[model samples]
Target: MPETTPRGLAGLAFGGDYNPEQWPERVWDEDVRLMREAGVTMVSVGIFSWALLEPAPGTYDFGWLDRNLDLLHANGVRVDLGTPTVVPPAWFYRAHPEALPVAADGVRLEFGSRGAICHSNADYRAAAANITTRLAERYADHPALAMWHVHNEYGVPVSACYCDSCAAHFRRWLAREYGTVEAVNEAWGTAFWGQRYSCLEEINPPRRAATVGNPAQALDYRRFADATMRENFTAERDILHRLSPGVPVTTNFMTALSQCDSVDYWAWGRETDLVTNDHYLITDGRRTHVNLAMAADLTRSVAGGAPWLLLEHSTSGVNWQPRNPAKTPGQMARNSLAHVARGSEGAMFFQWRQSRRGAEKFHSAMVPHGGTDTRVWREVTELGAAVEALAPVGGTRTEADVAVLWDWQSWWAQNLDWRPSEDHDARERADAYYEALYDHHLTVDFAHPEADLSDHPLVVVPALYLMTEAAGRNLREYVENGGTLVVSYFSGIVDEHDAVHEGPHPGALRDVLGLTVEEFSPLLPGERVRLSGPGGAGLDADVWTEFVVPRGAETVWTYADGPAAGRPAVTRHRLGRGTAWYVSTRPGAEGLAALLGQAVEDAGITPRADLPRDVEVVRRTGESGTFLFVINHTAADTEVPLDTPGTELLTGERAAGRLAVPAGAVRVVRLGG
Candidate 1:
């Protein structure tokens, strides 16, 4: 495995995306000076600079890039050099219009925006390879180069293309996956509605249809799109590796966002040398910190518990949201440190300097539009100092006792057109469980359902709708081997092809859960059912309900009032020395927390610390020592009881007993060697 730490960096990597090509040459000197003053150590360059790198077809421009790289090296700032392939130059697309992607409605998308080229387009692939090869060959041994950032966000604007090239590519991919049309028919359940194809050529990308499209076809198309993206990423990565041997390569992942659904990070993680992510806060009354923590945890898990990078986040308000609220006073610092608390060894942003023009003009950067005197720049400098102060955090690994199952295939199939409830979003369900664990100050790591669960004391699978036979067997083995398994409603209902299981509703897990569901009772919008359990522990269940019949599992919670009144809403089954718990309804936060608390107790798992609500704690162990990060996300001052003894890295003061963390602030306590 590639080491999580950046190769030559002395401390935690601190800086943001730097674009010297946007400004005049004189401004480049001033930017480097400012970066050093702010304690910036690294900057990502050449992102979205395809037009500048190659102004015309087969033409290259490296004079300006060479000057900037030399200047940054002289100023002691390392570089994460990007390939500038996210957006192809306009002239190439003008010459080969076939490279433009076609939308689901068959409208050919133009070349004005980024990610406009179809991944399967032969012309686009060739052009991308040519440019990447040139870049790697030119900068193979550059002293300033620290890492290779291959392409910007992959599936952002244009995830799937419906053009002829993509259709052909999709058929070819299906052939590779299924081997024959008959096998495809069996896997896709093409016999339904007489949708079976006689030949491989009949299949196409999931374009718009008169009625609902085939779910199996749509699922396969999603798989194909991800595979194409991975292939594209690997092509660039291979060029970089072959040319610049030891340099780490990565593509920034848009974690926990809607765009993340298109690619499988677990598979992508294997290709990249380092795992990195770009997460912007969703400011619509959602718990932005929770989302950030979730993204960081998932990124760390994808990196195999190694420290990852926070490739992008806004210093203030983002321009994209309907109402992009600016981060108050210390919110930016708090947000950045929250990522560090989880597993990120670096804290970076979208851009180093604010854009003077373009779509992202209003997006916050390290240096705001208002020069160095502004609050954004001041906060950026302070964050840079904080990151520099906590230099020992580099290469540290966050220890997680709980593993939450996150599967992209399950996520895709769960949200398919025909489901139990329209509101049954897979991520939201997973977040609900994750939030419950977060509420308990427990460190959590995301795990694929098929991943080994023996390492984690507690495994929570929320809304795993499409459970494969392998995954089902893995869960059974996990539970039978003394692991605690918690599964929610609508899980293990089908195989990989979106075909329902023959027996029980949660077909594959029925034996492990020791229960069978007679029918699914999906509640209407605003409709809810009451659930009651031991000691009058009650909560409202909404969205979905399963009429579960227990065979050998003991009832933990029952429906108090509904069509399935008195039915087991929650059941626990003991398999050998282990236990499996099933949740048949969408329980409210309090109820879910209570149930998870019971599971945590039963599994003999301990939290890092008992923290107040809205306060987060994470423990990272390394060669240096164990570092505990306590963050207060609330708007008021809070005190946390800390038993570990060590010096606080942020202030270089002794930390023990109780520590006061101000509102929107973080505390990094280095607990003993």
Candidate 2:
């Protein structure tokens, strides 16, 4: 909406969060100097400096931030100025204790960490607005101000607060959404638990009860909490937009992280002028690069297929994970370029200088505790040069070969209590499907279910338990229009109200899939099932199985031996000129690969089957020309099939026909450049 990317940057945006207040005033000079040496063009300042910026109510201290910005501008470094509203100062919290968030158990969260304020509290909103206005008034035209970063990572640590203020706010939100208490009762299915409300005032925030609360109410509360945070963001954003008309405003998003799930990124993506995300690796015995690529692709899609920035990633290990492991040599560059390969304007880290005394002190940074002589510093400088060399690829967008349906609302709805089985995880299904597509060398673009799907010939729905009527119609029409669709288990079961769709199981997708599941036969823990299809094809599945009765679909695979033995486990239907595939059980990796491979073929899409496993190839196209990125995440040297002759950006090597990608190395080719 603003410019599609961060403005006022000469090349690609490259830098990290800079906290000059954390260091002594004397270190400011050295910080900018090192930034220049590392090819840093921008730094986000004052994100958590609320306590320092406003020591007392209405008291102001901008001298330190002014000096820091001036010095960075003098050193040719741009600033992504923060509103410093994520955390209120001690005095403000002391004065307005009602601003503190209350747990679902009715215990008030003390003001000791970040994001402790209740979003519904008027005091916090007023304080946040005041600080934002003051900052906008002071630096609307500052030379170094390139972007306005709003409150840091909304819905992190604290999303919903069960305080009385929130209860009232929830009622008001319900009033606006449903318009009447009868409507709320109907939507919430209050007849079951005798929980019908007489009026909006009787409703609460789904606090602790004897048993599981109303899932419909729980779902609405999640939406309410997300909307409350968004309301605050837009309030601050409107101020910045009014004061600073052209400067793009953004709030770093953790779109792909499991820990931060309350915020619906699709809604937030529309609100931000420029979409940016902060991604950290989980390091949980999986391929971290795949997760990184997934995050980057998701962020780029959130930017509406435009170029987005990587606001925060680690140089090595992060401190918060249960097992923090350092990245091996060259792994950092590979991780960053993998994101670039998908579609990131540039690579940036959490902080420029690592913290010495803070909750995140053990977290890695560009300048680690060991400083410039360390391996991190050396790699940081190398990555800087690499990012600078690929400036021509900045505005270019990565073209996706396939589209994956991703909706946070469905994820939220599916995660509520009293589901089919605990083993059915929405995110896990998404990851499995994404990883399969990645292995097929298919670049993916995530789309909301109701979004236009005509452009993507192949659309995948890994897991979507909650589907709106419009989304169902969209999918049905897409299949009828000759677009191939692949859907996994536990999808299209419920509506927005957490109620099963009327008439049949598999609800909205019943017609499109040409099948209906009468009953879900979830397997016992540690149990597995085998499926046999035509031509003697065999697959192993676990976690779930279903008794699928075909309306018009052909059974491709049947449960060979399980609780639902002889039942259809996988089916295919011919709709219009297109095809729709239904998978009713969770298959192993190899089985999934085989099924997706067939679907890819049905969609008339060609994957890079020539590339070795774990090797990635992505292309970016724009006015600067087409650039092909070949990233090898394996341990052996491999060559990617390339027809066009071009100069490699990373090594300046001339290549034609085929490109050599060494083990753990990244190669960027400016095609015919």
Tell me the whole-model lDDT of each prediction, alpha carbons only: 0.88, 0.92
Q: Which stretches of candidate 1 lie above 4 Å from their native place?
A: 1-5, 607-609
State candidate 1's TM-score. 0.98
* CA deviation > 4 Å runs, candidate 2: none
Q: What's the TM-score of every candidate structure?
A: 0.98, 0.99
lDDT by residue for model 1 (1-673), tens: 4444565788888899998878999899899999998999999999888899899988899999999999999999999999988898888888999988899999998877788868998888888889999999999899998899999888888778999999899988988999999999998888889899999999888888988889988998988898998899999888888888888999999868875688888898888888999999888797889888999999999888888999898899999889998989999888999899888888988889999988999998998889999988888888889999988888888988789998888888887786767877778888899999988888789988788888888899988998888898999899899899999998999888989988877898998999999999988889899988898878898888878999899998899988799899999999988999999988889889989998998788875455678898788888988998888888889887877778888888887888888887899999863
lDDT tens digits by residue: candidate 2, 1-673 = 4555565897887889988899999888888889999999889999999989888888999999989899998999989999888899989988999999999999999988999979999999999999999999999999999999998999889999999999999999999999999999999999987898898999999999999989999999999999999999999999999998889999999999998999999999999988899999888988888898899999999889988889899999999988899989999899888888878888989899999998999999999999999999999999999999999998899999999999998999988888879998999999999999999999999999999999999999999999988999999999999999999998998899988999888999999999999899998899999999889989899999998999999999999999889989999999998999999999998999899999999999987778899998999999999999999999999998788999999899998999999999999999998
Q: What's the CA error at residue 575 for candidate 1, in Å? A: 1.2
Q: How well does model 1 score by local distance difference test?
A: 0.88
